[model samples]
Target chain A: MESFVDVFLFGKCYSVPDNLTIMGAMEYAGYQLVRGCGCRNGFCGACATIYRIRGDRELKVCLACQTKVENNMYVATLPFFPLIKEGFELEKVSPDVSVMMQLYPEIYACVGCNACTKSCTQGLNVMQYIAYAQRGDFAKCAEESFDCVMCGVCSSRTSGCRRSGTESSRICSPRSCRSPWRN
Target chain B: MYTGEILESMKKVEAARDANLALEPRRMTAEEKDALLSAYHPDYKESEFETLKIGVSRGDKVPHELAALLQGKPRIGAGDADLTKIDYDTDVLIIGGGGAGSSAAIEADNNGARCMIVTKLRIGDANTMMAEGGIQAADKPNDSPAVHYLDAFGGGHFAAKPELLYKLVNEAPDAIQWLNRLGVEFDKAPDGTMITTHGGGTSRKRMHAARDYTGAEIMRTLRDEVLNRGIPVIDYTAAVELILDENGRCAGAVLMNMETRELRVARAKTVILATGGAGRLHYQGFPTSNHYGATADGLILGYRAGAKLLYADTLQYHPTGAAYPDQIYGALVTEKVRSLGAKLVNAKGEVFMHPLETRDVSAASIIRECGDRGNGVKTPDGVGVWLDTPMIERIGGEGTILSRIPAMHRMFAKYGIDIRVEPILVYPTLHYQNGGLDITPDGMTAVENLYAAGEVVGGIHGRNRLMGNSLLDVIVFGRNAGRCASEKAKSVEPGALTLSHIDAFLKERGDAGIEGDTVSPKLLPVYTHGNPDVPKKPF
Candidate 1:
């Protein structure tokens, strides 16, 4: 027998298959959620969200990439920007030059949304560097990126940005990014 | 003018003219002149130095007539020979690339002797990288080395070597300072003092960490230091046999390059075996967190080389690993969790062990409870118990918990359990080995030229190792063994071993198995024959 799962996103509820992941079910429901450069193995913590199951009063947190959809579960996707100040660690960032280039393109996608810049506890210009990276000027990007402690705060806030798509809309598709070669 | 032999004959004439000047000259025959010209200027056609004009001076000059003779040559090897097979006569050769081997390499290098490190994996990929707890040291104002030594002795059931234990406790703080100088980012307090926390079987808060990844941090720093100093690291090279000379002094080793199936002989005056513990041979349900490559290669190599093995039976089982069905089921849950105030509970949600008891005792109690199924708690997966999450939430905020311990959150989520809201299913798993190749306080083995350190050595952790002390053991004793090996290496000369001797060494290794065959079936004899009656613990 196939089990049906009802996932409540924001305020709307939709039924999904038991086997589909929560991120997969959200896409099937026709809502477009902004996905980051998805390293779906769950180490990146890019797709993290606050979730709760209906009638199960406990609040839980999980990465949407790894979590499967549970029946009658409530998930609120927090944008990647707001979480930077609280969750970023300076030490985890790779000092690789090539990885810096791969992250350059999306950094320019910042729309002057001070949401990430202001959210940075490290006081970095998250908005300015994104603009610089988008312009193909890396020197400026490197300069502004200095303050980034790589807490994933900017990514966390922008992950579910309202401007990219409607909050009610589910986004389930994975984004493509260049792979960093292992030396 | 002069023919080639006539010019050589003129050199004989010059020698006769300067008989009182202590000069001897010989005339070249026709064939010899041709050979000398061909050999001295072999690459004359490709010579860049041939462009230079020759001149003569009274004091120091080259005769223009001999300009062709002075032309540079392209040096070629005697034949198409394998340079990697060229025997390097060094004073010491260290095996294993974890804390012990690396320390020995640094110590040997600083002591002005040629040193080489052959590791089964990358230099830093040993159990040292997987250590999550901080290193323990007696750095607190309230703590003393005597107290620390007593604690360690008591924990090990007094089976630890008193001298080694004494050296480890006293020098551990300096080792920590050495790591700091090497750029290990230890967690710090507001006043700039190193942050200390608690762990199993400790009276003081002596554990220092970089969040939960203390071992990773230490290994990274040490690896960087090793690299910066230009120490030769032969990665993916497994030491298959310890080479013993006729006199029975530990000499060198035969290594198999894992990438290429090639056999090479490393001839050294001294050899140090720093291969880590054997943790993967245990039965199921007992989590062996050791890397797949850690199969007691060092122990077997040392034992075959005639070094006496000690305390091979005592294994330390960490009390908290994620329960079954998870891929990392037996993976370590940092003891910092307990230090942060998490408690062990049975299925009925009652705290079972006296939360402050030693790790071995607590682990035994948990094992007993799971076996008995008392307190309404049945083993979840033959060894499962539960950890109360409410306490974890109270001590570490949910944000801190979610951020710092993302794995903990993932482990619970996999089981359909929310750690923030419910109890976590846990069990004891193979964590660390308390025994290995026996060594002196300076890490010298019974074999004259051999030494051992890190998890590969025994008596440092008698029965149970404190949470943070494992990292300290790697650095402190690793440095000690390294220094000792270097001193021995400096005074010693590479012994004379002929081609026939090298062939014999290669033949002995050939009997072990195929070169670079890590999966050789011949290993069965070493495994099945030893300690048959004793129940093996997962390490």
Candidate 2:
């Protein structure tokens, strides 16, 4: 017989197989998810989740597709992140901090709470990359934030900058817009 | 990440590295290659394939999983979708939002054609985003399109269609230039010369990349370009069935809103199916290195619309998929690792095969090593050989692995395995559908006005694809499909739209005595862990 563990999905308790991922456990509990599921692998970043252990106040973030179920785990899926990307022609723009400021505008609003860094599932130094964007060090920001999956966990935990800090790090990357400084 | 006995094998690999550096495995002769493939390749296992009972290629043999999908019933009845109530209409309708679809939309828009993209997931969520290897383009002075074509033809065992192969190799350099103009960051030297490397079966250094995130970077750039062009993209919507016109030319498709379970009709003068490969089908129950949306949707829809398939019996298994750690099983370990200098070693710390062999030969050799010789490392979940990754750092000095393949380093690092310091366990995983809907040089299917591109179309890579050609194939054929479809759309008028094809398909299946309880265009794979037998129904 397969051993089961009790997990609370949005505060409702269900017993699912201990070996299953949080995604599989949700399905085992009969929830046919439409939104909080994507590329069952770790690449897509569609299944960013927040959870806590029983009687533990330390919150953790992970991709639900990758995390295994734990006994008495409390899970919440963040399916949609409110991101309204400001459109700009990548060809005409340079990878400068001023361009990022013009597009996002809120990059200066970061209060250095470090919550964004703590919430990152990819383990990226979110605040450090944002600091790079602030100082016009786009190359450094690009290299540091190359692993960003755009999961929006950093924005979800922030109060001042919303998503601009993380978004600026991505915009600085040469992958999106070219840099005249680059040889 | 290895410990205990596996770590001991790692030590053996380390002890043999200096000697293995100079090792050169003998190349296989044509007769030897044929014998090895026939004996070990998954496609050569005759029992795994079955003849199709219905559709344009009725008697063709495809894998058993594919035969069922081809013979399966449509998701909806003919009466359920009203073609007259067109929800969205455009000059060109592009299905799928991967690299091909995005490229098609951009090209069509450039030709003054109004294009609307309908995709199952958010834009850029197709298999194109998962590709890690660089793209092939014979732009170097030492290389020419003729040489690239010859290499590809030989690698595919001379089964690739001549004209299609010619077009792919010829257009590749220009395709790379196009992506560069659109801001795709290819790895380049200080003087702006593209830094190129050799992929499997390549005679010259023609593979261009932006490190290991080559596809991700290209995809994001294309997605940005598509968005910036102000093209309308309908996300979370899939084309469940193709709508044929009264004249039997492909006209439009029935779109399913995956979230709302609502059906909508998209009528277009020309339709392009860029829906990608069938890796997510997990053919023969093999773990796949495909995106979740790669369930052979376009193949099923196109076949039902009377398009013939080419080389449907073949699939390409990427030889280096992560074999240990159940959570990350079957994830692709890019062939760039080998292109940079990593070698494949058996559990006994012996260099088994030349690392740069074509995908099929490499996969077969790995299987032969594991099965025939019992030279694979046994794991709790399965068996795999060592992809001696640390040799890359040793050959190129430290920090090379981090600079060149950071995505790979980070992927393993997440699981507590630092690939820069340790080797990874690997086995072949289903990676690409080498065969799909047959198309002309310009990507037009047998059904007039309908087009296919990317992995959804076949004959570009006959029975097996070399490492970097797939990325090139998408851009080359994608632009072809888009330009031709747009030009064709200008001269044509939208004919009567109907879903009578579904009725005809069902009738044909019934008449052929093909009985099965399956419905397809299987948009997603079911992962209800506790209830494996539950039917696949959208939430």
Candidate 3:
């Protein structure tokens, strides 16, 4: 016997089978996704999503393909957010804070707010890494944020989140930096 | 949680860890590997494949599922599309936006060609991003391109085309250096020396990585370079069919908007098909470690465009996919684990075959243990052997697994399985498509003005690919295809565009009485729960 749960996807309610991931339940309810889905594993951050439980006031961000459904869960896929992206030639750029600032000056605008840190789906110390970037300790910043999937949840939460990622990427010398997209 | 008996077996594995650490199994010779592959490898099983009835590959044996798609009808007819309306015009049109496509676009743009990238998903959303092991490059003082060529040549069983193999090996070091110059942050030692490690079938430790996220690092770097160069990338748009000129030269492709179902026309002087592989087909009913878009889109598209495929019958099954804890089944457990000193142990908690053999040999050994010997640990979903991951920490010391393979550790941790303290069950999962469109050393396919790179181009790896070479293959051949295609684009002009090749392909299938409900270039695989029509395990 199969149990069912009510999931509100983009404000439309559907009774989906229990034990299905949010992505799976959407498909089970017959939504052929054209967007907000990538690797179908957790690697690609295409399926970044925000949801809330029936009684909880707090919103949670997660990879929809990896998170299981809860009864009365409210789900909405995160759309693409247009952010400031600068372009530069890698051969000419130096691994210094000055180059990072020249490309993205917005890193100085970080207010030390923990909003980006709390909003990270990958549980990275987003604010701390950003501070490291601000202090020109980019090697430390690169190590702390190596596992970031660049889901942009952090950027959605704060003003300085976008450039912080690109800052760490700029400082990714022969050090251990694995930015999902340094751009 | 593991079953009680499985837990009991794990205890045995833990107890025997010290012995397993010192265990040294003899490596198989070429002839021995050949005998083992013939007797155990799934590719050698004749009943699993059938001869094609239509198209250029007619009478050639291939998997039945693929044969159906190969014989599938064209999505658009010759007269259906408006060839007069070209939305995007470029000198080089690169299909797919994975590593290969990105590499192709970068080099094409570098060669002074107006290039555009079109992908089914986001630019960096690809198997390349999901590749967890490392990239191969022979740059160490002791390792030369000659040695690298011999290692790769012998690894592929000497069946690899010498020209393509030579190009791949010779240019690998340069490719690595290019990526480094492009801001790809490779792992380095304390003295600023690049760190290299061993991969399966490698004589020297030439594998360079950005920790466990080698592919992600490389992919993100290339994608950033593409964006930095202002290369036009059409996201969420897939190339449904390749368009050819009236003179039978490759012109461009018909692009489909995955969301709006709108058709877009792209006209170009040359087309580079880097559309990647077919693991999403779930060949042999096995779970795959591919991205959602790895549905063999390039194979069918190239086939319809009058290109010849090589070794379509062969596929690479990665030996260490997670097989237990049903939720994460079929996810990749990278070969880096084996390279890091993990051992494959059977039900009796004993070390099995040498874990560092080629993927095919390693997968066959696992299958033999699970099926023929009945030594696999059984659960409701399937059977799998244990890969002693804790041995990595035992060998490399504490914090090794966490730092070296963070993504892997996080994946298991999500399922409440701490791999640092225990072993994980593994089974062979469909990993790579070893063969595709046959190409020259420079990535020119059978069709003029059509080039291929990455997994779509076959014959570079012969029947099997070694670890790290795939990442190298994308950059090496992708740059070659891009640079050569752009140079060729300078002199040639596209004639009147038409879908006559697809029309001819469909007509051939119709004449052969080969009918299918499916369409070519299957953009996305259908995934639904509890489809009794599809077998659970074909093997």
Candidate 4:
């Protein structure tokens, strides 16, 4: 018989296959996926989940696709958060600090709490990049977040990494017209 | 951005190119191709390439010793005899997540079957994503299914299966409609007619594309719909074995989690194998453009489940894949580049074979020219012909390279080679498998409940597939398999497990006293430049 580990999933206790990842355990618990799952490999950061024990206060965050679910652990998947995005003509925009603020003003909402950096699936220093964005240093922020797959995990874990898809590449990609500088 | 005035002028250039295409690029006659093939000793039987198990073969009855490598793994007991657990149960289980698998899943779901997709990678990460060429479909009045059929038939050297070929060309317009309905944005001209272009062997402009990322556009659209429909998918799970019922009917499959290495079973009424090609097999000592998971897993699974394989020895080597510049090695340079009027010039600045010849003949001509006649330019990477990309910009004008072939332009640009100004060195690279599990026109395998679609099945394009027919092949057969399997699933009850079929297969092989390689297709020799056993180009 396969060993089963007890874990609290969405507030219900269920026994699932031992040594299975969080995504595997959630499926084994009959949770049908609509979102919160992207690459299934760690390449996409969509499945970032948060968890904690019943009595312990250590709030833990890990990618559900890679992290194993522990016994008696309570977990919840972070839904894609709503983020502000100001659309404009790419060729017309000057792509400066004023444009960045006008496009995603939510970048200014970062607290000193480093939760976004702490919970990053790609090991990106979200707090540092948020500071860079806050300081109007688009190049530094783009370099720090070059590998973002826009899984939206960083945004779900923080107030500052608000917008995804466009924001991640807009601040970074050389192909984007708003890139800090051409490579 | 196109206007009728611009199109009228573009037509003039196209008209001029059409006039000179014959004289400028000398077309190789059939006799000429046969001579080249003869010089290269064209059979893939490995007598010339050392003991490497690479090369092409026309087909012969395999002696028992060499047949064991193609057999499936030993089957597990029964569907439920072990009384352990059924990890998943669905009305229709789709095994791959490429364009075919996604399209099939959508159609099956539409037919009211509970469908599940199991893939070896992320649902969207497939060779379908890597594909940049347009899809072939007879959507224009000037082009018809008959014309497409004739082109495909001639391209395959008349070796393609008639029924499969007929269905492919006939159902193509409807397939394009299905894709459009599913939100695939095909490229269009000023008059809103789908942009049509010729591939290697086509007679007319019939390929409907989306910029250069036609496959990506269609694949991502289908993937989004699959998500929208809430169709369950077990990503990163490879279908390692097919489960058979007591009567030798396929009941379901055994899946292995690629990352966790955990074994899981699925009891499904119908199994659709949409896993793509075996280009990674590195047949004939060529690098491949297939995805990482294109290792014939579905072939091994179906062959093990009592399915008869077809044309098992043939492989498709696309004519112009990146052979120089180490980083982008083996990437397919879309045939659209040729359709746009580029030329293949040798190191001596002499024009080689006609740029528009079918892949097999064209690839063979390059091999004979470079490896045999020593006319190919010696580069740090390899000897090859240069595909004059700048000629495309010259013919199509300023933004043509950026708009029509952006993915390619962007890829080369990243490597510091501006294709608009310079040429790209290319050679033949393994592209597709012309042989796979044999299936009927309706996508039914020899096994009662087993089905197949996409590049996984064989005999659709006999010896060679035309450039754009692959995208057409996937959707046409994908929808057929999905709809048929769903209708069949609606009527059939849950099947009983059969362990006897396994005993029967092993007994048959044993009674025949089969010898030779019993290794998995994954165990086949792959040739990278660093590998010591990499076969040298056989002249």
TM-score of each candidate structure, all chains considered together: 0.61, 0.94, 0.94, 0.71
Docking class of 2: acceptable
Give the deviation of candidate 2 from the true structure as CA RMSD.
Answer: 2.8
lDDT of each: 0.58, 0.85, 0.84, 0.69
Cα-based lDDT at residue B130, candidate 1: 65
DockQ: which candidate is best?
2
Report the Cα lDDT for residue B191, model 3: 87
Candidate 3 global TM-score: 0.94
Q: What lDDT does model 2 reach?
A: 0.85
Which of the CAPRI classes, incorrect, acceptable, medium or high, describes model 3?
acceptable
Instruction: Say which prediction, candidate 1 or candidate 3, comes out ahead on DockQ.
Output: 3
Worst 10 residues of 3 chain B by lDDT: B530-539
Model 2: CA > 4 A from native = A1-4, A16-19, A28-33, A94-97, A158-183, B530-539
Least lDDT summed over 10 consecutive residues: which range in candidate 4 chain B? B49-58
The CA lDDT at B506 in model 2 is: 88
- Candidate 2, number of clashes: 0
Residue-wise C-alpha lDDT for candidate 1, range A99-122, written one tens digit per residue: 434443344334454554554433
Candidates, ranked, DockQ? 2, 3, 4, 1
Summarize candidate 1's per-residue lDDT along B172-281 as a digit string, tens digits: 88988877765566777667699887777788888888766667556655655566567788876766666655666677776666556466678887788887765554
**What TM-score quantifies how close candidate 1 is to the native fold?**
0.61
**What's the TM for chain B in candidate 4?**
0.88
lDDT of 3 at B27: 89
> What value of lDDT does candidate 1 attain over all alpha carbons?
0.58
